[model samples]
Target chain A: MARTAGSSGPRTEEAIRSAGLALIATHGYAAMSLRQLAAEVGIQQGSLYNYFRNKQEFLFDLIRTHMQDLHAALDAALAPEGGDPVERLTRFVEFHVAYHVERPQQVFICYSELRSLEPDNLAAVVAMRRDYERKLSDILDAGRAAGVFRLDDVRMATLAILAMLSGICTWYKPGGRLAKDAVREIFLGMVLALARGEVPAEAVEAAPPPALSRRNGVARAGAA
Target chain B: MARTAGSSGPRTEEAIRSAGLALIATHGYAAMSLRQLAAEVGIQQGSLYNYFRNKQEFLFDLIRTHMQDLHAALDAALAPEGGDPVERLTRFVEFHVAYHVERPQQVFICYSELRSLEPDNLAAVVAMRRDYERKLSDILDAGRAAGVFRLDDVRMATLAILAMLSGICTWYKPGGRLAKDAVREIFLGMVLALARGEVPAEAVEAAPPPALSRRNGVARAGAA
Candidate 1:
């Protein structure tokens, strides 16, 4: 949907979207004003409607576009279907870390601006997120069925993996401590560890049985 | 500092802090108005200053208080020093989950509002966060030294575990699909597994060694 009513229409629309992402990321969506956005985009305030209906619609579009791109990129990055589950998971981890590391602003806005969306838009975005989460959950389910993945709850495992991966955007810098490949390798190790069920040798040895440990003071401390 | 300048002083300050947190959390720090906060707390707009110096100061106070409370609660919940690293890690997961699950708004503001703080306040809050991260990293280092925790990078592992655990607040509801205890148990399992560094048997059998796998087609995909 390029706004190509005129020769400059597509360029202006692209500019508006870029500026809008930056503005809404730095300032919360509620604090952002149409006039300030137009100023940032170097367009007249009244002419902004040519790109989107209003601030609310603009936000909806930004978030929707991010989700769409994310799904498309994920599908392209995923290994062909019917591959081994462990290989599938490894590919998924690498893909997620690479995709999100470069787009911190989009990731931040998609999360922080959900509260600013109206009820219908909120429902739409939430559905898209569930679809994404389901992709990972489906992987875990398949692994469990094949007796390759060990998990008490597949849904919880799915959520934990996604959160750990997505959180990379919060702290990752382009020239920071770890290179991109290093991050991918380290995260893949953790994800595979999570999928496997082996407890550390020391932990296995010193840790009391769950039921007995609970009865002997660990329960009270845990409850607190 | 209790603002007990008069009988109603401390109560009013408490109301202002509580209302400000809700308003800032629902809207954002930049979008929340002092007048709205005063109205929510049922105080005269002009009298809002009895508690804090200005909006910036107020925002700083809200975040600083959250950090302080979190540190204090963690200290109180931790097991006695020199305990088994596995047990310490387990206790940390439980305590963090319980604390943040109930205070979603505070957690949201503490993370999302960091950008709105002035430079000095921002630096202070950031230092607090680093201190918090260091506590977990220290535990991981100790575990590694004891030959119990199997991680290549202690800092990365620490960040991953905290992010996964803190993420419980994003989706948890009082009576959702799983109870709090169940969530805690499942996460504990994941954390302990992460420390153990055990890959699945099937994965090990199907995958090549790290160096060879990187040279093979996996490296190309990872780079992309």
Candidate 2:
């Protein structure tokens, strides 16, 4: 109930959070034990209780903190409200790739271990995720309104763009063949192209426009 | 080592695999014990060993089988070897979405539980995955050679495309507002646009082309 009594309390809690993230990322939430986590943090098993009431709470805190930090960082990184949607989208892609590329473990745990969260915790995390998604969705909406982007379905595009950016976390290495800057630039080009609906004129002529019109209907109806 | 000794052997093995997928999907590979798996399957713990020698093997088999089936299905679904890259890319997208949509549990486990596989098993699975990526990568390469797809980096494009399509599994629900056909069409459109290097003319005109030339150089050197 009360904070662990000492100057070392916050430091120890930070250690526990780091250790828990690594353990859960490696073995998953259900497979990670409080005892194992405490051992990893070099603390007594009971001392974990001083930081969190139970494992669910601990897991929730880890993910919630990650989302909170992400949202805050995104807010700081984004182009200001009412700015050009292109600039905002560009900033979004750069921020997302840079943020995710540096924290692959966090991204991995946040996505993969989401199944381990309890119902309420899951709802909270899902809500946070939706809020995060809405930021990009809003950018797409603005781009569409400004006649700068031509997306068939903004929501689908949002999910696809987010997934594509986040997927970088799965394989990106700090000292890998491509530098972070190069990766970011390449992805930026792709994301901007995607947002702009840059399909070739010949391809557009080749395929029927029914999917576009239908998707527009669906998007307007808020069905997808 | 030997079969479970009856017509029921294959049936029971199928049951174990189903239950194992559900359990691992919900609780993860490490947290799923042989006892729990057997209990779920209404068999004795020892019976699991009749099929899988250990949990690691069980996990490995689950992912490996998924990859094998995916490859086989993909091979069947792809356009003929010398066909148009656009058509091949289209088929790849449809096949991927269809295959992965019906098997979210398999997709989740294949990505999440890779951490649970032993090193050798991991390598085998990784190789299988690389082979899958190559299917998509080769299509992009062929498109590039034909001057149909103007990708900055074929490898990056391949990963991005796969990540975007596979991401549908995370949020897609059967009987949801969007039909599978519609979702597939939308994704196909986006992937085609991406492969075609469809950035808006204005956006390209606005931004410096340094990234493009650099990426082209990198792509030519096979550096990315």
Candidate 3:
């Protein structure tokens, strides 16, 4: 009976966690309050205690939820094929962009505020983060094994790629100037050029863009 | 008498601004106060009013000082020395890495906290950032013109490179795992490989590194 109640409790916990995630993403964890979170969930402030112990606890649950969702989503998105690096990379890119666009709040909060968690929660978040990074590094190493990508420092390459792609969150909004599809296309194209095994010196053809502000890679949230 | 006072005043003002820059770089701008800034300068709190109108004015002045430093530094660093596009690109990378490593605190604060500025300050920062980016875009364009580099999209390419180098602050501690020179070499090599106009489709020679740590790239103040 206890196990059943505990398992079923996720419904209430999920709603509370979602509210916390959205608030923390926009305002940063330092500024969010439990009162506002409870209000957003349409529950009495006291009822929130059923899901989380305090603001810190609420944030912990949200970070954990974001991490678990990300891991599960990435696994679901990985292509069935094993050794093909480009295919694996392309799928990784697609999954990342989709996940970020679909759940911008979760991604943004997880990235920015997970460090503010309690000791145990911080440990858990750090572990989850290491797991994700290792997954990316594994993909790159596998590509090296399969002779698909080239790098002197695979660690730095992974970090660079991760940083560049994650930067999408900073400028990307739901109804931005560029369509999400175009943004993905442009980003994918740039990565492809970098990832290609042998781009001859003659192939560097960066053209002057129409205008910097209207840069096509600015992805809208829903369209892509 | 007026001329001497004016000259000394400019020097003293620069000293105060420099001192504030160092303080804000480590403590964060929001958490820091104008009172502390005045104390750091050996001036009474009221004297700060004479130098700048108010707290926001003083903060804006610090940001503008840093921005001017950055713009001029990058411009001087990337002057089109007579060389292959790869060489020019290497110079740019070296300058970016060297400066970031040397002034890790200033670079870190400037990148991360510029967002917290008021609307007017934020616009000024955005414009300065755009100016720096435009110079890089032009280099990529010129590289294309010279047929020394291959890129899919110029604007995205610029962002990718900037993000990659900007991320050095997250990992490159002045006293850390890799020495400054080694970090520069590794970073430059990977960037050159990307910029050299040949996509390195072949995998790297080493065993796969462990998965990367994703949380590393997420926050501004957690470089620890």
Identify the candidate with maximal DockQ: 2
The C-alpha lDDT values of all candidates are 0.78, 0.79, 0.66
Point out where model 1 deviates above 4 Å.
A1-7, A200-224, B1-7, B200-224
Tens digits of lDDT, candidate 2, A175-210: 777877667767877888788776632354374222
Candidates in order, interface RMSD in Å: 11.9, 10.4, 12.3
lDDT of 1 by residue, A1-224 (tens): 44325549788889989999999888778778989998997777888998888889999999999999999988876636767678778767877888888798898788879988999999999999999989888888888898878888899899899889888888888777776666776777788888875653234335533321111100011111
Model 2: CAPRI class? acceptable
Q: Which should have the higher lDDT, number 2 or number 3?
A: 2
Instruction: Name the better of 2 and 3 by DockQ.
Output: 2
Worst lDDT run of 10 residues, candidate 3 chain A, spans A215-224
Q: What TM-scores do the predictions have? A: 0.86, 0.86, 0.72
Across B64-84, the per-residue lDDT of candidate 2 in tens digits comes to: 889999899899887367667
**Ranking under lDDT, best-scoring first?**
2, 1, 3
Enumerate residue pairs that collide in model 1: none
How many residue pairs in model 2 have overlapping backbones? 1
**Model 1 residue B2 CA deviation in Å:** 23
What would the per-residue lDDT of candidate 3 be over residues A11-106, giving only the tens digit for each residue?
Answer: 867777667777777656665666787789766677778775677777787778778989997887764646367666756765686567667667
Q: Write model 1 residue lDDT over B1-224, tens digit each, in one string.
A: 43334558778888888898889888788778888898898766878887778889999998999999999988888847757777777777778888878888888788888888889999999999999889888878877776667676787899899889887877787889987877777788888888766542335346533222332111112222
Among incorrect, acceptable, medium and high, the docking class of model 3 is: incorrect
TM-score of 3: 0.72
